[model samples]
Target: MQNEPLAYRMRPQTIDEIAGQQHVIGKDTALYKMIMNGHVPSMLLYGDPGVGKTSLAFAIAGTTKLPFIALNATKAGKKDVEDVVADARISGKVILFLDEIHRFNKLQQDTLLPHVENGSIILIGATTENPFHDVNPAIRSRCGEIKQLKRLTTEDVDVLLKRALEDPDKGLGKTPIKITDDQRLKIADASNGDARKALTLLESTVFASFEENGVTVVENGTLDSLIDRVGVFGDKKGSHFYNLLSALQKSVRGSDTDAALYYLAHLLENGDLVAVSRRLLVMSYEDIGLANPAAGPQVLAAIQSAERLGLPEARIPLANAVVLMCLSEKSNSAYVALDKAISSIHSGKTGEIPSHLKDTHYSGAKELGHGGYVYPHDHKIGTFGGWVNQTYLPDNLIGTRFYDPIDAGEEKRLSAIYNKLEKFKKEK
Candidate 1:
């Protein structure tokens, strides 16, 4: 028999054979009972790649004795789907696994919904993209959603690596493979918590391992080279994604425009445009709030434009927005203020909004003097006198400055405005 690819060979045949995804697949769960009872639901498994979505579907098929038919949204068409449903009718019970189900256009997805709803076929749709956004609502409504968790924690990765190292039939046991503590740590590090990618990397390392001067072992050097060979990140789904996120956050915090730009490039090169846009959107407010309030708006607009115009054309607006954010003045005063407020609440220091600031729309509110609140915007010179409401920010912190403006274009104007406001206050 021809040797199967390590991915195929390593495919888990049962729930016991599976790794990770314990939250959903653990004992006596609704989904688990369905799998064991041969009555699994028409479901959608959504998460990052190589996190066992497809594997779980196959395991469900194996456990239920259901006829399994696999389709790819990237390739399958209306005709292909129709044929699968027709076959499922004769097969008695079927589990039709559709990979990258999000890529299916609306009409194609709509065709599957009726068959799934009527129980002609138990549909197992899988996608790396969020099904809530990417899957057609009609199809989504007909299926139970199972969100596969992303890779996290070294313990999870270690458990997976040890299993792969020991499983003789499916893992590196067929060949002479041994891992040192450093190699194990690096493997775990490289995987970021994704078992499939870790195993693949482990297999590659064993293949690369050779006897040097009659000393045959997969040591740290061989493992490092294999890690590089497996790619900058063995798990494209996990650590690599978060590493770039970390880099982006640090760039914004350190006010390094160049570093932020570099992180953007890295994310784009890895085909993670969505992640890049998301971080930029977050960094805009979290790191750049108040100092350059326009930064968040600009990032959001860029993302909208990118959605309207994709790839090469879209790249320009995205890059332009990133550069603008990097060059913009940054402040975390909003974050700091919220943190203080949260801490105060946690410490049981919560205070009610003063009567002057409270709503006066109700019947008895006017009698309670709620409507007597001063309108600061309508005051002469646009500055109210003795209108201080120290209920939320505390008496001592009433005028405490937080957002110190930098020399960026917009912030320079903001600083000037603040200076002018201070002069007015002094003259009052």
Candidate 2:
């Protein structure tokens, strides 16, 4: 317990201890009352990371004193569901906290249907993405209600920080630390409504500022050093460089060519081709993804040309890339999908690679259950096709699709291909 991070150690034991999300976990809320009564219902919890999804699930189980089994959809397979069912058989009921529940494909979700229907395995699904957009309809329909945990308020984060500083058992109360109230608030503000981030910063400040005499003074300079981990555009916190980059990206993403060009010129005038180029490349994929597949290479080419041309001349190719990004059909579906996949991984959802997808080039690989590799080239569907319905993901994440192309420009064609492949896979 002492070795665990402060955030983990400070997780709310019951919903009452939860910092924010009053609308759901407040004492007067029906959900709070239900959990207090030991009625743990199957439900979906969605929100950005660090907003207490897992904490809420754990708090519910704690309040109810029920068997809590936490698993991640990207890692857990049917066997995991069976384990929960088996636990329910003995305990009469079990709370299965399925993190990244949106990653559960059809087969895995289907396996839970009977158990969920019988009230043996009460499902508590948690995800950062919109459940309706990613979760299968069957699971969504069965869940009582999809609850969204909003980001923690600054006040809420500050409250947690203070609590952590004072709580001897689960926090840093044992350490002799000193910090101004303003500095504390600054930490909260820097965290941007993330309690975990706030705690991490507080912990960092304590350790970095700790003196040889067993005392710590958390100063603004120490905080600045730790908080500069983000904002690649600037060395100082909240500098104009960061503002320009943010404005530039937002302009391009919003399809404001004029604004995008304005910011690009401002950045170019500031004389940092590398930063501007890096941002343009990101905008190509992050803002104008598959909708304009060529935008990536086009922007890359522009960057290379600009690099060779240098300075005032570099602005020419750079401007071209910027305008192209702004006017192009915009779609963030690609990165959104990837972000969801990344969120699942961050939530400890990574699983072993499926046997069929494992490398078979090594000696004695077949004896290790790494056989049955399917060559997609062998099953060509149609023209412009070297594809087959194969399980390329881990067995648990078999049907998870991490690249959801949108209906825009070339991505429309990609979406069509994706839909066709999905249909074919389902048929098979």
Candidate 3:
């Protein structure tokens, strides 16, 4: 057990050890309450890689003292699930943690449905993919709750790094290692929200350095060498990879065609197709927006082609998407309007839904004055239009506006329609 990798040895024994996921594992949350009460349900843990899915499963089992058996879905077949079922039958309920549960075929997943349904097997399916889109619906619905875990922030990773260094039993407390606060934080930042990466780099950096008279010293450039293993972050300074991505987005948004291409070339040279594809797709909507509505679909098509092609062949389509984004008419109105609406919600400017808009589908809803909603389709004022004015907002905010469409691209037409709607609203 002591010879295991640092990340494996440092698995969180309880929810308290898992950082940056207070939404699920917080003391006041329903999941935490259930765990403390010794009633953990079968659940699907979904998130990016290294985001504590398996750690959470281990923490739950440890807290409840349940038998935990982990099996990778990619390698585990129907027989493996049956073996776990046999164990469950002989020794009471067991926690079956299925890593990469999305990879299991329908038949393999179906084999465990009966055991999971009978309460003999407590299923904990962990996957980096979204279960809603990837998993079999039968398996998804059987899992009572789906918990989403997020990547640890730099600060959170730094905290974990400190704990790993200080713990005497499970960590390197006995080792005479000297690492400064900023040096530790540098490893955390380079980790890119992965706790495993931070700890692994710390272990590697500590071991790679020559031992001085008494201690292993982690100097300024120690972590830089470790980060250089991945080609995308070869920014000499060790932190310019994300900065380069930001420069690409800003250049496209500013309509600097040459600068956008320059950044794109540099990012391409790093061989990070996933990163490049993500930035292009975001730029299509966030920069070009409704001004060039077609830009989104065009960029998506180009990206799909690039992904299918891969690498040097992929760069051609990626460059096309970048050039189109740089030249497309720009507008941020779509997301800006959404941001204003979100701000209003946060500021407590919301009121109860108007009586007409309230749900009338339930029993006895009409008796409570919930079916007063007027159908606009029934009151047509023109042959081509079935428009009737109705107040969607509450009475307190009848005139409050959230969307202010700019006169750019297709929004010019949308702006004219918006004015007409407002005119009819005032008359009503």
Q: Who wins the TM-score comparison?
A: 3
Where does candidate 3 stray beyond 4 Å?
230-328, 331-406, 409-428
**What's model 3's TM-score?**
0.64
TM-score of each model, paired residue for residue: 0.61, 0.58, 0.64
* Candidate 2 C-alpha lDDT tens digits along 70-164: 99999998888888888899999889999988789787877787899889988999987677777888998889878988878889999999999
Question: Each candidate's lDDT (Cα)?
Answer: 0.73, 0.85, 0.85
Assess candidate 3 and give its lDDT.
Answer: 0.85
lDDT string, candidate 3, 1-428, tens digits: 66888888888998778777889888889999999998989999987667788889999999999898999999998899889999899979999999988887877777788999999999999877768777888889889999888778898899889988988789888888888998899888878777777778888888888789888888777668887763332342122456578999999999999999988987888778888898899989988888899999999999999999998999899899999988888888888889998999999999878989999999999888886778888887655367778878988887888888888888788788878878987886
Clashes of 1: 0
TM-score preference between candidates 2 and 3, better one: 3
Q: After superposition, how far is residue 142 of candidate 2 from its true place, in Å?
A: 0.9
